[model samples]
Target: MSRVSNMVAEFVATFPTTLRPGVLYVSGAYSTAAHLCCCGCGHEVITPLSRAQWVLTFDGTVSLRPSIGNWTLPCRSHYFIDSGSIRWARRYSEPEIEANREHDRQLLADARIDTPGGRHPLIQYCRSVWRRLRRL
Candidate 1:
Protein backbone atom coordinates (compact mmCIF):
# COMPACT_ATOMS: atom_id res chain seq x y z
CA MET A 1 0.00 0.00 0.00
CA SER A 2 1.13 3.54 -0.65
CA ARG A 3 2.21 5.67 2.29
CA VAL A 4 -0.05 8.51 3.37
CA SER A 5 2.08 11.62 3.45
CA ASN A 6 -0.50 14.35 3.92
CA MET A 7 -2.29 13.53 7.13
CA VAL A 8 -3.96 16.26 9.18
CA ALA A 9 -5.09 16.23 12.79
CA GLU A 10 -8.36 17.65 14.07
CA PHE A 11 -9.63 17.90 17.62
CA VAL A 12 -13.34 17.66 18.22
CA ALA A 13 -15.60 16.97 21.17
CA THR A 14 -17.50 14.32 19.28
CA PHE A 15 -16.27 12.30 16.35
CA PRO A 16 -18.01 12.92 13.07
CA THR A 17 -20.40 10.16 12.11
CA THR A 18 -18.71 10.08 8.79
CA LEU A 19 -14.95 9.89 8.51
CA ARG A 20 -12.80 11.44 5.80
CA PRO A 21 -9.54 9.99 4.58
CA GLY A 22 -6.27 11.75 5.44
CA VAL A 23 -7.61 13.32 8.62
CA LEU A 24 -6.95 12.04 12.13
CA TYR A 25 -9.78 13.14 14.37
CA VAL A 26 -8.80 13.25 18.02
CA SER A 27 -11.18 13.77 20.91
CA GLY A 28 -9.54 14.02 24.31
CA ALA A 29 -12.94 14.61 25.86
CA TYR A 30 -14.18 11.30 24.54
CA SER A 31 -10.76 9.65 24.75
CA THR A 32 -10.67 8.44 21.15
CA ALA A 33 -8.70 8.86 17.99
CA ALA A 34 -10.09 7.95 14.59
CA HIS A 35 -9.14 8.00 10.97
CA LEU A 36 -9.83 6.26 7.74
CA CYS A 37 -7.61 3.37 6.69
CA CYS A 38 -4.40 4.77 5.24
CA CYS A 39 -4.38 1.90 2.76
CA GLY A 40 -7.17 3.78 0.90
CA CYS A 41 -9.56 0.99 1.77
CA GLY A 42 -12.09 3.57 3.03
CA HIS A 43 -12.61 1.73 6.31
CA GLU A 44 -13.05 3.77 9.46
CA VAL A 45 -10.57 3.00 12.23
CA ILE A 46 -11.36 4.05 15.76
CA THR A 47 -8.79 3.67 18.51
CA PRO A 48 -9.99 4.07 22.05
CA LEU A 49 -7.70 5.72 24.57
CA SER A 50 -6.62 3.49 27.42
CA ARG A 51 -3.51 2.42 29.26
CA ALA A 52 -3.68 -0.96 27.56
CA GLN A 53 -4.80 0.33 24.20
CA TRP A 54 -3.70 2.92 21.73
CA VAL A 55 -2.30 6.18 23.04
CA LEU A 56 -2.35 9.34 20.98
CA THR A 57 0.55 11.74 21.32
CA PHE A 58 0.40 15.24 19.92
CA ASP A 59 3.46 17.42 19.72
CA GLY A 60 2.56 19.78 16.90
CA THR A 61 1.93 16.51 15.03
CA VAL A 62 -0.02 13.40 15.93
CA SER A 63 1.24 9.86 16.55
CA LEU A 64 -0.25 6.62 17.82
CA ARG A 65 1.55 4.01 19.86
CA PRO A 66 1.86 0.26 19.11
CA SER A 67 0.92 0.79 15.47
CA ILE A 68 -2.40 0.02 13.82
CA GLY A 69 -2.89 -3.46 12.46
CA ASN A 70 -6.04 -3.91 10.43
CA TRP A 71 -6.05 -7.64 10.90
CA THR A 72 -9.74 -8.18 10.34
CA LEU A 73 -9.97 -5.96 7.31
CA PRO A 74 -9.71 -7.39 3.85
CA CYS A 75 -6.69 -5.19 3.21
CA ARG A 76 -4.99 -6.32 6.43
CA SER A 77 -2.78 -3.27 6.40
CA HIS A 78 -0.25 -2.69 9.16
CA TYR A 79 1.42 0.64 9.73
CA PHE A 80 2.49 3.20 12.25
CA ILE A 81 0.91 6.63 12.57
CA ASP A 82 3.75 8.97 13.42
CA SER A 83 4.23 12.67 12.96
CA GLY A 84 1.47 12.90 10.38
CA SER A 85 2.95 10.15 8.26
CA ILE A 86 1.89 6.57 7.74
CA ARG A 87 4.91 4.30 7.87
CA TRP A 88 4.01 0.97 6.37
CA ALA A 89 5.12 -2.10 8.27
CA ARG A 90 5.92 -5.38 6.63
CA ARG A 91 3.08 -7.86 6.39
CA TYR A 92 3.00 -10.44 9.12
CA SER A 93 2.67 -14.17 8.66
CA GLU A 94 -0.32 -16.04 10.06
CA PRO A 95 1.69 -17.30 13.00
CA GLU A 96 3.07 -13.86 13.68
CA ILE A 97 -0.44 -12.43 13.63
CA GLU A 98 -1.65 -15.02 16.10
CA ALA A 99 1.30 -14.35 18.39
CA ASN A 100 0.64 -10.65 18.31
CA ARG A 101 -3.01 -11.20 19.08
CA GLU A 102 -2.12 -13.37 22.06
CA HIS A 103 0.33 -10.75 23.29
CA ASP A 104 -2.36 -8.10 23.16
CA ARG A 105 -4.78 -10.31 25.06
CA GLN A 106 -2.19 -10.93 27.78
CA LEU A 107 -1.46 -7.25 28.06
CA LEU A 108 -5.14 -6.47 28.57
CA ALA A 109 -5.45 -9.18 31.20
CA ASP A 110 -2.41 -7.81 33.04
CA ALA A 111 -3.81 -4.32 32.96
CA ARG A 112 -7.07 -5.50 34.46
CA ILE A 113 -5.24 -7.39 37.18
CA ASP A 114 -2.94 -4.46 37.89
CA THR A 115 -5.55 -1.71 38.00
CA PRO A 116 -4.35 1.07 40.31
CA GLY A 117 -7.15 1.32 42.85
CA GLY A 118 -7.55 -2.29 43.94
CA ARG A 119 -8.47 -5.80 42.85
CA HIS A 120 -10.68 -6.26 39.82
CA PRO A 121 -14.38 -5.71 40.36
CA LEU A 122 -15.28 -9.41 40.26
CA ILE A 123 -12.55 -10.33 42.71
CA GLN A 124 -13.49 -7.49 45.06
CA TYR A 125 -17.14 -8.51 44.98
CA CYS A 126 -16.25 -12.10 45.76
CA ARG A 127 -14.07 -11.06 48.68
CA SER A 128 -16.79 -8.77 50.01
CA VAL A 129 -19.34 -11.59 49.89
CA TRP A 130 -16.94 -13.93 51.64
CA ARG A 131 -16.40 -11.38 54.43
CA ARG A 132 -20.15 -10.92 54.88
CA LEU A 133 -20.66 -14.69 55.09
CA ARG A 134 -17.89 -14.96 57.68
CA ARG A 135 -19.50 -12.17 59.71
CA LEU A 136 -22.83 -14.03 59.54
Candidate 2:
Protein backbone atom coordinates (compact mmCIF):
# COMPACT_ATOMS: atom_id res chain seq x y z
CA MET A 1 0.00 0.00 0.00
CA SER A 2 1.27 3.45 -0.89
CA ARG A 3 1.36 6.05 1.86
CA VAL A 4 -0.17 9.45 1.15
CA SER A 5 1.80 12.22 2.78
CA ASN A 6 1.09 15.92 3.19
CA MET A 7 -2.68 15.44 3.31
CA VAL A 8 -4.76 18.58 3.72
CA ALA A 9 -8.38 19.24 4.71
CA GLU A 10 -10.61 21.85 3.09
CA PHE A 11 -14.07 22.82 4.29
CA VAL A 12 -16.39 23.65 1.42
CA ALA A 13 -20.11 24.40 1.32
CA THR A 14 -20.25 22.21 -1.79
CA PHE A 15 -17.75 19.90 -3.42
CA PRO A 16 -15.67 21.58 -6.05
CA THR A 17 -16.27 20.82 -9.74
CA THR A 18 -13.03 18.92 -9.83
CA LEU A 19 -11.46 17.08 -6.91
CA ARG A 20 -7.77 17.30 -6.26
CA PRO A 21 -5.62 14.55 -4.90
CA GLY A 22 -4.13 14.89 -1.41
CA VAL A 23 -6.95 17.15 -0.26
CA LEU A 24 -10.00 16.06 1.75
CA TYR A 25 -13.02 18.21 1.08
CA VAL A 26 -15.50 18.33 3.94
CA SER A 27 -19.06 19.60 3.52
CA GLY A 28 -20.74 20.00 6.88
CA ALA A 29 -23.89 21.36 5.26
CA TYR A 30 -24.28 18.16 3.24
CA SER A 31 -22.80 15.90 5.92
CA THR A 32 -20.24 14.42 3.57
CA ALA A 33 -16.52 14.09 2.92
CA ALA A 34 -14.91 13.66 -0.49
CA HIS A 35 -11.38 12.93 -1.53
CA LEU A 36 -9.40 11.28 -4.22
CA CYS A 37 -8.19 7.75 -3.57
CA CYS A 38 -5.15 7.93 -1.29
CA CYS A 39 -3.48 5.12 -3.23
CA GLY A 40 -2.93 7.50 -6.14
CA CYS A 41 -5.59 5.67 -8.17
CA GLY A 42 -7.40 9.02 -8.72
CA HIS A 43 -10.83 7.59 -7.99
CA GLU A 44 -13.12 9.95 -6.11
CA VAL A 45 -14.30 8.65 -2.77
CA ILE A 46 -17.39 10.22 -1.31
CA THR A 47 -18.18 9.08 2.24
CA PRO A 48 -21.49 10.12 3.67
CA LEU A 49 -21.44 11.21 7.31
CA SER A 50 -23.96 9.31 9.39
CA ARG A 51 -24.26 7.32 12.60
CA ALA A 52 -24.38 4.10 10.59
CA GLN A 53 -21.51 5.06 8.30
CA TRP A 54 -18.42 7.24 8.38
CA VAL A 55 -18.08 9.60 11.35
CA LEU A 56 -15.85 12.62 10.91
CA THR A 57 -14.05 13.89 13.97
CA PHE A 58 -12.22 17.17 14.26
CA ASP A 59 -9.79 17.47 17.16
CA GLY A 60 -7.40 20.04 15.80
CA THR A 61 -7.07 17.61 12.89
CA VAL A 62 -9.63 15.78 10.78
CA SER A 63 -10.14 12.05 11.23
CA LEU A 64 -12.59 9.38 10.01
CA ARG A 65 -13.56 6.15 11.64
CA PRO A 66 -13.97 2.57 10.36
CA SER A 67 -11.40 2.86 7.61
CA ILE A 68 -12.19 3.31 3.91
CA GLY A 69 -12.15 0.07 1.95
CA ASN A 70 -12.21 0.51 -1.80
CA TRP A 71 -13.10 -3.08 -2.54
CA THR A 72 -14.63 -2.27 -5.89
CA LEU A 73 -11.56 -0.52 -7.22
CA PRO A 74 -8.88 -2.42 -9.06
CA CYS A 75 -6.41 -1.36 -6.38
CA ARG A 76 -8.78 -2.36 -3.56
CA SER A 77 -7.00 0.05 -1.25
CA HIS A 78 -7.84 0.08 2.43
CA TYR A 79 -6.75 2.81 4.80
CA PHE A 80 -7.79 5.07 7.62
CA ILE A 81 -7.87 8.86 7.31
CA ASP A 82 -6.75 10.03 10.70
CA SER A 83 -5.62 13.49 11.74
CA GLY A 84 -4.87 14.38 8.13
CA SER A 85 -2.73 11.30 7.69
CA ILE A 86 -3.24 8.14 5.67
CA ARG A 87 -2.68 5.04 7.79
CA TRP A 88 -2.70 1.99 5.60
CA ALA A 89 -4.66 -1.05 6.63
CA ARG A 90 -3.92 -4.68 5.78
CA ARG A 91 -5.40 -6.05 2.58
CA TYR A 92 -8.44 -8.27 2.95
CA SER A 93 -9.16 -11.64 1.38
CA GLU A 94 -12.19 -12.15 -0.85
CA PRO A 95 -14.06 -13.94 1.96
CA GLU A 96 -13.22 -11.15 4.38
CA ILE A 97 -14.50 -8.59 1.91
CA GLU A 98 -17.79 -10.45 1.55
CA ALA A 99 -18.12 -10.67 5.33
CA ASN A 100 -17.46 -6.97 5.74
CA ARG A 101 -20.07 -6.18 3.10
CA GLU A 102 -22.63 -8.30 4.92
CA HIS A 103 -21.81 -6.60 8.22
CA ASP A 104 -22.27 -3.17 6.67
CA ARG A 105 -25.59 -4.22 5.18
CA GLN A 106 -26.84 -5.42 8.57
CA LEU A 107 -25.75 -2.22 10.27
CA LEU A 108 -27.63 -0.13 7.73
CA ALA A 109 -30.69 -2.33 8.09
CA ASP A 110 -30.61 -2.02 11.90
CA ALA A 111 -30.24 1.71 11.66
CA ARG A 112 -33.32 1.95 9.48
CA ILE A 113 -35.26 -0.19 11.93
CA ASP A 114 -34.29 2.09 14.81
CA THR A 115 -35.29 5.30 13.04
CA PRO A 116 -38.33 7.24 14.39
CA GLY A 117 -40.62 6.45 11.46
CA GLY A 118 -41.26 3.03 13.02
CA ARG A 119 -39.89 -0.43 12.34
CA HIS A 120 -40.52 -1.99 8.95
CA PRO A 121 -43.65 -4.14 9.04
CA LEU A 122 -41.72 -7.28 8.15
CA ILE A 123 -39.06 -6.55 10.74
CA GLN A 124 -41.70 -5.83 13.39
CA TYR A 125 -43.47 -9.11 12.67
CA CYS A 126 -40.21 -11.03 12.88
CA ARG A 127 -39.31 -9.38 16.16
CA SER A 128 -42.73 -10.15 17.65
CA VAL A 129 -42.44 -13.80 16.65
CA TRP A 130 -38.97 -14.08 18.17
CA ARG A 131 -40.17 -12.54 21.41
CA ARG A 132 -43.11 -14.94 21.64
CA LEU A 133 -40.89 -17.96 20.85
CA ARG A 134 -38.38 -16.93 23.55
CA ARG A 135 -41.17 -17.00 26.21
CA LEU A 136 -41.98 -20.68 25.50
Candidate 3:
Protein backbone atom coordinates (compact mmCIF):
# COMPACT_ATOMS: atom_id res chain seq x y z
CA MET A 1 0.00 0.00 0.00
CA SER A 2 1.15 3.53 -0.74
CA ARG A 3 1.72 6.09 2.01
CA VAL A 4 -0.76 8.54 0.56
CA SER A 5 -3.38 5.81 0.25
CA ASN A 6 -2.94 4.88 3.89
CA MET A 7 -3.24 8.49 5.00
CA VAL A 8 -6.41 8.92 2.97
CA ALA A 9 -7.87 5.77 4.53
CA GLU A 10 -7.27 7.12 8.01
CA PHE A 11 -9.00 10.32 6.98
CA VAL A 12 -12.05 8.42 5.74
CA ALA A 13 -12.22 6.23 8.85
CA THR A 14 -12.02 9.29 11.04
CA PHE A 15 -14.91 10.83 9.17
CA PRO A 16 -17.56 8.20 8.51
CA THR A 17 -20.42 8.75 6.06
CA THR A 18 -23.24 6.80 4.41
CA LEU A 19 -22.21 7.58 0.86
CA ARG A 20 -21.22 4.56 -1.13
CA PRO A 21 -18.42 4.02 -3.66
CA GLY A 22 -16.20 6.95 -2.86
CA VAL A 23 -13.33 7.06 -5.28
CA LEU A 24 -10.01 8.65 -4.20
CA TYR A 25 -8.29 10.24 -7.15
CA VAL A 26 -4.65 11.34 -6.96
CA SER A 27 -2.92 13.48 -9.55
CA GLY A 28 0.71 14.43 -10.08
CA ALA A 29 2.66 14.33 -6.83
CA TYR A 30 5.79 15.89 -8.25
CA SER A 31 4.59 19.32 -9.22
CA THR A 32 6.45 22.53 -8.38
CA ALA A 33 3.55 23.66 -6.27
CA ALA A 34 3.18 23.43 -2.49
CA HIS A 35 3.70 20.49 -0.13
CA LEU A 36 1.87 17.84 -2.13
CA CYS A 37 3.65 14.53 -2.60
CA CYS A 38 3.65 11.30 -4.59
CA CYS A 39 4.58 8.03 -2.99
CA GLY A 40 6.00 6.78 -6.27
CA CYS A 41 4.91 3.27 -5.28
CA GLY A 42 2.88 2.52 -8.38
CA HIS A 43 -0.36 2.90 -6.44
CA GLU A 44 -3.25 5.36 -6.27
CA VAL A 45 -5.32 6.14 -3.17
CA ILE A 46 -9.02 5.36 -3.31
CA THR A 47 -11.78 4.98 -0.73
CA PRO A 48 -15.41 4.03 -1.07
CA LEU A 49 -18.05 6.16 0.65
CA SER A 50 -19.34 3.09 2.48
CA ARG A 51 -16.62 2.40 5.03
CA ALA A 52 -13.23 3.45 6.39
CA GLN A 53 -11.41 1.37 3.84
CA TRP A 54 -8.82 3.28 1.75
CA VAL A 55 -7.79 1.23 -1.20
CA LEU A 56 -4.54 1.49 -3.14
CA THR A 57 -5.70 1.07 -6.70
CA PHE A 58 -3.19 0.57 -9.46
CA ASP A 59 -5.71 1.52 -12.17
CA GLY A 60 -6.08 5.17 -11.27
CA THR A 61 -5.53 8.67 -12.57
CA VAL A 62 -3.58 11.78 -11.49
CA SER A 63 -4.88 15.31 -12.00
CA LEU A 64 -2.55 18.24 -11.48
CA ARG A 65 -4.40 21.44 -10.90
CA PRO A 66 -3.29 24.63 -9.13
CA SER A 67 -6.78 25.64 -8.12
CA ILE A 68 -7.54 22.99 -5.51
CA GLY A 69 -4.38 21.30 -4.29
CA ASN A 70 -0.78 20.57 -5.19
CA TRP A 71 -1.08 17.31 -7.13
CA THR A 72 2.53 16.30 -6.74
CA LEU A 73 5.69 17.18 -4.84
CA PRO A 74 9.06 18.56 -5.83
CA CYS A 75 10.78 15.21 -5.42
CA ARG A 76 11.16 13.17 -8.59
CA SER A 77 11.07 9.91 -6.66
CA HIS A 78 7.49 10.70 -5.66
CA TYR A 79 6.43 10.27 -9.25
CA PHE A 80 5.38 6.64 -9.32
CA ILE A 81 3.33 6.11 -12.45
CA ASP A 82 3.36 8.00 -15.69
CA SER A 83 1.36 11.17 -16.24
CA GLY A 84 -1.76 9.20 -17.31
CA SER A 85 -1.33 5.64 -16.22
CA ILE A 86 -4.38 4.02 -14.61
CA ARG A 87 -3.26 1.82 -11.72
CA TRP A 88 -4.85 -1.09 -9.81
CA ALA A 89 -7.05 -0.95 -6.71
CA ARG A 90 -7.08 -2.86 -3.42
CA ARG A 91 -8.82 -2.32 -0.09
CA TYR A 92 -6.60 -1.09 2.72
CA SER A 93 -6.95 -3.23 5.82
CA GLU A 94 -7.69 -1.89 9.33
CA PRO A 95 -4.12 -2.34 10.44
CA GLU A 96 -2.94 -0.28 7.52
CA ILE A 97 -5.26 2.56 8.49
CA GLU A 98 -3.90 2.67 12.02
CA ALA A 99 -0.34 2.76 10.83
CA ASN A 100 -1.12 5.44 8.31
CA ARG A 101 -2.88 7.53 10.94
CA GLU A 102 0.28 7.77 13.02
CA HIS A 103 2.36 8.57 10.00
CA ASP A 104 -0.09 11.18 8.81
CA ARG A 105 -0.26 12.76 12.22
CA GLN A 106 3.46 13.26 12.12
CA LEU A 107 3.26 14.66 8.62
CA LEU A 108 0.60 17.16 9.62
CA ALA A 109 2.51 18.24 12.68
CA ASP A 110 5.50 19.17 10.55
CA ALA A 111 3.67 20.46 7.49
CA ARG A 112 3.92 24.07 6.38
CA ILE A 113 0.71 26.03 6.37
CA ASP A 114 1.96 28.48 3.72
CA THR A 115 2.03 25.77 1.08
CA PRO A 116 -1.05 25.56 -1.06
CA GLY A 117 -1.63 21.87 -0.43
CA GLY A 118 0.59 21.57 2.58
CA ARG A 119 -2.27 21.75 5.04
CA HIS A 120 -4.26 18.56 4.85
CA PRO A 121 -8.01 19.15 4.95
CA LEU A 122 -8.26 16.48 7.60
CA ILE A 123 -6.05 18.46 9.94
CA GLN A 124 -8.12 21.59 9.48
CA TYR A 125 -11.32 19.64 9.98
CA CYS A 126 -10.00 18.04 13.10
CA ARG A 127 -8.96 21.41 14.45
CA SER A 128 -12.43 22.75 13.83
CA VAL A 129 -13.94 19.85 15.72
CA TRP A 130 -11.62 20.42 18.60
CA ARG A 131 -12.51 24.08 18.70
CA ARG A 132 -16.21 23.27 18.65
CA LEU A 133 -15.82 20.77 21.43
CA ARG A 134 -13.95 23.35 23.45
CA ARG A 135 -16.76 25.85 22.98
CA LEU A 136 -19.28 23.32 24.13
Candidate models: Cα lDDT each: 0.77, 0.78, 0.31
List TM-scores for all candidates, in order. Answer: 0.79, 0.80, 0.26
Q: What is the lDDT of candidate 1?
A: 0.77
| Candidate 1 Cα misplacement greater than 4 A, ranges | 1-3, 116-136
RMSD of each: 11.3, 12.3, 15.0
Ten consecutive residues with minimal summed lDDT in candidate 1? 118-127
Residue-wise C-alpha lDDT for candidate 3, range 1-136, written one tens digit per residue: 2334321211122322322222333221211111123343332222221002111222234332111111232322322222233222343455764675676556445654434656444444444544554465
Residue pairs in clash, model 2? none
Q: Which residue segments of model 3 deviate by more than 4 Å?
A: 1-82, 113-136
Pairs of residues clashing in candidate 1: none
> For candidate 2, lDDT tens digit of each residue in 68-98?
9999999899999889788989999999999
* Candidate 2 displacement at residue 134 in angstroms: 52
**Per-residue accuracy of model 1 over 1-136 as CA lDDT, tens digit each:** 3446557888776789888888998765556689889998888888866667776666778788888999999999999988888898999999999999999888788977888663344444434443553465
Ranking by TM-score: 2, 1, 3
TM-score of 2: 0.80
The true-versus-predicted C-alpha distance at residue 74 of model 1, in Å, is 0.3
